[model samples]
Target: MKRTGKRIISMLLCVLLASALSTTALAAEDGKVLKLAFTDSPTLVIGDMTIYHPSYAAMLAFKGAFEKSTGGEYSVELYPNGVLGDAASTMEQMLTGTITGSTPADGALSAFAPDIQVFTIPYLFDNPTIAYDVLDGDFGRQLFEKIAAETGFRVVASYDNGGYRNFTNSKREIRTAADMEGLNIRVQDSPVYLEMVEALGASATPVAFLELYSALQTGVVDGQENSCVTTLGASLDEVQPYCTLDGHLLGLAFLVISDTWYQGLDADTQAKVDEAGREATIAARGICRYAEALAVDTMVANGVQVYSPTAEELETF
Candidate 1:
């Protein structure tokens, strides 16, 4: 009777252990991991230029919305401040399925989807409202489909990179195109940007975004052009004391994912991903617009001189 009792106890313990292991396995198999990366500080504040930078905030919003909406069927991981890599490298990773997604500037993405460079054209969109209408409407969907077909990558959503590109310099204020002459200006390492700067009479010097602050501080480049939020986020306003509100280019970026990974997901999951992307896009655009609206005043308080060109002065370009 004692031996039989001992045998019964052992069997019960074995059953319990097996049940625990099975539950663990099921938990592990229940969720899929989605990794997203971008290059930007998560948060920054200088004077009144407070920023929960769009690149970082949008990814966080996507992660939260996706996880909740998917009911734990999928999990999102974010790599910010170039923890994974620069914009170009991150985009390459997404293409190869090394990463699930990334937010890359149109200039960086132009390498893979040349048509995206059209956004680089100076003054392409007259205002933010128009830009949003075109990007969030049917035209944007058609463009995304075309890009997916060509590159095997899916563009999930569009983001306002800051607002509009403006010129800032360590030298004198640039109120007109003529004021740009003889200034060695830093530009993204893209042909279109180089050409645009050269056409404006400045010697265009291509510089990596990471190295821009040091380059400006050391006089490697006399000035650079970017949205006010971008300039303030990087503390470029501290180095470049003068600003010209030229509104030359509408800053834009895309949240992109591997089409292969996306297609592999079940229909329901894909829909959830798309919904998350839309939410993220809204969060990004809102942050950019808020920052831009207050950027000039913030810069002024911080000792940067800002000049807005009159219609006549603007046409001088």
Candidate 2:
């Protein structure tokens, strides 16, 4: 009886330790390993290899640069496939310095800086070029600063989450917003996404990401919108038969480090971290292009009909 009681207490302690986001103690106890976490999908592909997610590709690039720049002082350990938790949970860990950094989508980042909604506005930029130029320029830098000020995160980069969100539905091919009348669209459980769908003349239905496939299959929603990287990741192409390249929202993801954790680093180390992050950002674009191509190809192969809407046509939506 006494031994069983001790074993039970030990198990409880282990559970508590895992639940706690106490990175300082962890860093000190486990050597100089930095931890990072993100969702499972084509991004990390359930922690498997594929490298189809831009953020994951950036993470891979950052790993090597970080090791080289840090002079072998710190090594990164990843908890991919949402093993650590969802974007929101991981962001909490990062902010608390329980983890080193993260690259959640702009929607997730909005939880930190609500102004991020500005980027999510439909048709904000004409193309990826314009989006990159603006985000890689002063406007992007200033916004990152604002994010740091408002939230306790030192945002390092805004890597392309790849391509723009397009319209996908099992119902019919959508060429313009006018075609969206009365369609039921699944959106993220957020006000901004709800607004976007509503603006397109569709009723917005909020559903959890993990349950989206079942929702679409069950007729809970008629359509959805997302980047190719994610559309492929969720295997939505298997269920949704039609796609229109509306290019509505430019998929932007932010890489953020804990402000307090960053401040604690030596000046040299901090510079190296920033350098690695920048390198990751630059490396990600090419990777994003490839992943997007592959995703589109995959969808087409799977029998999803894709349409490209003209700028004037999209404006009607």
Candidate 3:
């Protein structure tokens, strides 16, 4: 009887210890792994410079570095190429805690942060370098921090997309806004883009990026606006002929995460994660600028009717 009672006590103790260990693991007092979903298109093809594309492989570099640096305790689950949904949907998901993070263009994020939309306004910056200083400086940080406090989203880094340049399949070179009359320009589904295209006198059509090439080929739209990198990265040269260096607006992207999911992490882990994201953002931006320069040179060499408007020609807009 004594032996049996001792055996039963040992079994009960083992069970209790196991349950306690399980609870501790679940609580993750030390640290936890993080999964972040980004906006991207599923069928978007990759290129030699795809790694430098802000929304694609460049993000992967961020994810890898964060995971490796943290010794696997912290990690990201990147949903590239819109596997999660469009930029808007992805942002919504992050807000609801269904997703941990996202990278959306400033114009796309304007619906959430109106101040960010200001960057998309016409003639916002003379060039990418000036834009970068504004974004990485104290004013940008304060603005982003305010956005986070007000909107329950955290902006870790500001990413750079290529300059918002214009392109067309039509034969005429657009030297002035008057030349844009009656042109059906395909634009990303952003109100800022729509407004700007309207200002330039084109009938702007909102279309997803993947469908743009086919749209231009079949006359669904007569032209579009994007950076040199996107024009080449997407192989748009196959369809669009007249590439214009309008430099209409500066483009900016952000690596954002849900405040709720982020707050759930311990402070130390969160700091490391934030630092990693910042590094990734800087790296992605640099990669984009380099890729854009190369894309422009390559496109010019490939018989693209590249147009540089004269100083007087640029004033019509």
Which candidate ranks first by lDDT, i.e. highest?
Answer: 1
User: In terms of TM-score, how similar is model 3 to the real structure?
Assistant: 0.77
lDDT of 3 at 159: 65
**TM per prediction:** 0.83, 0.82, 0.77
Measured on C-alpha atoms, candidate 3 has an lDDT of 0.74
lDDT by residue for model 2 over 1-317, one digit each (tens)? 99999999999999877754464355457556778776854342311336656777677778889977765567777677898899999999887678888878887888778887788777888877788888779998898878787788877767668777888998988988889999999988878789988987899999888999999999999989898768877888888999988887887887677777777888988899889888878777777777677777767877889888877887797
Q: Which candidate's TM-score is highest?
A: 1
Order of all candidates by lDDT, from best down to worst?
A: 1, 2, 3
* Cα-based lDDT at residue 266, candidate 3: 76
Task: Write down the lDDT of every candidate, Cα atoms only.
Answer: 0.85, 0.80, 0.74
Q: What is the per-residue lDDT of model 1 for residues 131-183, given as tens digits with 9 covering 90 to 100?
A: 88988898888988899889977887788787899999998988888989899
Q: Write the per-residue lDDT of candidate 3 for residues 1-317, one digit (tens) a residue.
A: 99999999999999999976665465355435454666554222234433445655446766777777766555466677677788898888878777777888877687898888767777777678788788879988889888888887788878667556655555567777898988999988777788889888889999898888888888989888888877876778877778888788767888887777767777886887678777877777777676677777777777788887887877777
In candidate 1, where is summed lDDT lowest over 10 consecutive residues? 23-32
Greater TM-score among 1 and 3 belongs to 1
Better of 1 and 3 by lDDT: 1
Each candidate structure's count of clashing pairs: 0, 0, 5
For candidate 2, list the clashing residue pairs, or say none: none
